[model samples]
Target: MLKLTDKQALEFGIQPVHHQMDNGELRFRLTRDTGSSYILTLSAEQSGWQSSHVHLRKREFYIVEQGWIVLALRQSEQLTFRRLGPNDSFMLPPGLPHNVYLSEGSVLHTVKYGSADADWEAAPELDEKLRHETFDGKTFFTR
Candidate 1:
């Protein structure tokens, strides 16, 4: 799991609230004062792949703080797979269908414009292909 150094934590000037998810992942909610929020998440190797979903109105930004992760995004009839590692960042606009596969020791830092629980919508149709497809460690495009 990636963590903030003492110097880094002091620089941020914010306290984080910790939570343990049901999937055994560790999450830290860093800020929630305004309409936006920041979150830090550490994924367990055994956490497996996440289901496909989309946000109807919310937007999200993510940075890979440690280890590796695969983001599978579907746009229209085409699908794109992006393999991300430390320092890699991406943004998801509203109405984009996506899923994530976190590798062992993966850590992600996220910024959200709104509450995920309220805007999240499931996209079960993408699950079958997204979960079973092979990622080649590069950006891949498929129909």
Candidate 2:
């Protein structure tokens, strides 16, 4: 994994054209012409949520670059919740139902591979409220 500087993150974040989903989530597509793989950065400020969906053809990895996030994963009939901070990452394989909830002002750097387009379903019925903390390498609660 690459450790991004503030300037690099800002520059990369500004490159892709972003759009809002039917659920009102906001994501910036960072990579163009990458062919079979794409990068995206999600914003909590826009929708207060992340990807509440499942991919059947590609694998998705959520890497926390800034702030904090509480991720919910439902695989096979089991559900789990995890709180992650900067540099922490989690992978959701194909056929797994996963949802990520942003902590007010969270930012997640995500990557999807092995598929050119997304074959997924958005899960709006699994809405949740997350309670967690962020570690910014300085003050834990000052973010």
Candidate 3:
């Protein structure tokens, strides 16, 4: 396994992709790809949400680097949500639908494996309520 420090990862550089959300700009930076797995960093310049999505053949995982992310996962017939902060990590098996919302100016590191290209099916309506909420350092609340 290849492990890299934050500085090392930065030195490797990233291909940043930006998306405009209703709330703010969401940036996804792809840093490494190893055919079987990809390493990337994501952040929201202001505040925004990533709609729920599922990858049919890849296991997805992420670690919080700065601020927080509210992660919601759906499996079987249940949906659960967790608020994660720095150093926190979570993973989801293939076929599970999950949503990740980053607090304003927050950062997250992600790893996607078991597939090369991402085949994501979006389910934004799954957590529509969260779309209107905002994170305020310690907690999330409706704005």
TM-score of each: 0.72, 0.63, 0.67
Candidate 1 error regions (>4 Å): 1-18, 30-35, 114-117, 134-143
Q: Count the backbone clashes (under 3 Å) in each candidate.
A: 0, 0, 0
TM-score of 2: 0.63
Q: lDDT tens string, model 2, 40-87?
A: 555544434454677887787888887777667775556666778888
Residue runs of model 3 more than 4 Å from their true location after superposition: 1-23, 26-28, 31-42, 127-129, 132-137, 140-143
Task: Give lDDT: candidate 1, residue 126.
Answer: 80
Worst 10 residues of 3 by lDDT: 31-40
Task: Between candidates 2 and 3, name the one with more favorable TM-score.
Answer: 3
> Pick by TM-score: which candidate is best?
1
Question: Scored by CA lDDT, what does every candidate get?
Answer: 0.77, 0.62, 0.68
Please give, for residues 1-143, the per-residue lDDT of candidate 3 as tens digits.
99876667656553434454555544454534432444444464665567778889888888888888887777665666778899999987888878877777677777777865656788766667455555566764432
Please provide the root mean square deviation of candidate 1 (C-alpha atoms, Å).
6.1
Model 2 clashes, total count: 0
- 1 or 3, greater by TM-score: 1
* Segments in model 2 whose C-alpha atoms lie over 4 Å from true places: 1-15, 20-26, 31-37, 40-42, 124-143
